[model samples]
Target: MNGTRGTIEIHLKELLEEAGLSKNKFCQRAELQRSQLNGYLNNTITRLDIDVLIRICDTLDCSISDLLEYKPG
Candidate 1:
């Protein structure tokens, strides 16, 4: 079996960290639950919501493109 999942990956945690904001701060500012945000940051989430992404982008002052990227594996 191929040990690869996909080339596309979410860089949410990196973007958030680059914003220089704590997870709690970002969650509060974005009106998002901490648990969900943690899931995203840890890459333990199975799916992502468009609304959440929009909110995160808005709060982080970053575009969706900045939150996602293609990394060949």
Candidate 2:
């Protein structure tokens, strides 16, 4: 796979840090699994289900932009 194309990186940890929340609490509030959270943290996975994304945004009390970021090649 290309290093950049079609890849999405999420700054989930950074956002959570800014919000002063722990991973466990954030995951609980967001209703996301540990594996899914790890994937976003490690940048090893792309694509989020709409439901998950919505939950995260809701938990963070922010828009999608506040929880996620995009880098393009």
Candidate 3:
């Protein structure tokens, strides 16, 4: 699965793990709806809502760069 891909993915799960945050806790702290966050986790997130992203970064005490990563395919 690691090598089977088209576009490279963001390392959001790693960031969440590093922050020691569960999706439930993150949603509460970030003031986001659970379903919306689940959508992101499930890779069904079509739009990146800036406010939600900002809230998540702030709640996690991380920069946007820490929450995101880019890899070339």
Candidate 4:
């Protein structure tokens, strides 16, 4: 197989906006640090934590697919 990999995009910012939630509020509700959330928002997180993903999904009442999208590279 080729070494190509798809990108995993995080739509946290858009989701938060759609939910009418501020970053600070979301961080508080998700029990996440502002910097950590910022990493996800900026797409700079190298690793995806399942617990964090679950927290975000639970807090936003959204499915994993709503928060992330995989695009072929």
Pairs that collide in candidate 1 are none
Clashes of each: 0, 0, 0, 0
Q: How accurate is candidate 4 locally (lDDT)?
A: 0.91
Q: Residues 37-59, candidate 2, lDDT per residue (tens digit)? A: 88877867645678987888888
| Minimal lDDT window, size 10, model 2 | 1-10
lDDT of 4 by residue, 1-73 (tens): 1126878889999999999999998999999999999999999998889999999999999999999898888
Off by over 4 Å in 4: 1-3
- How much lDDT does each candidate structure score? 0.80, 0.77, 0.72, 0.91
Candidates' TM-scores?
Answer: 0.79, 0.78, 0.72, 0.92
The residue ranges of model 2 lying beyond 4 angstroms of the native Cα positions read 1-6
Compare candidates 3 and 4 on lDDT and give the better one.
4
Worst 10 residues of 3 by lDDT: 1-10
What clash count does candidate 2 reach?
Answer: 0
lDDT order of candidates, top first: 4, 1, 2, 3
Candidate 1: stretches off by over 4 Å: 1-7, 71-73
Q: What is the RMSD, in Å, between candidate 2 and the native fold over all Cα?
A: 2.4
Error in Å for residue 42 of model 3 = 2.4
Candidate 2 local Cα displacement, residue 69, angstroms: 2.8
For this target, which candidate reaches the highest lDDT against the unseen true structure? 4
Estimate the TM-score for candidate 3: 0.72
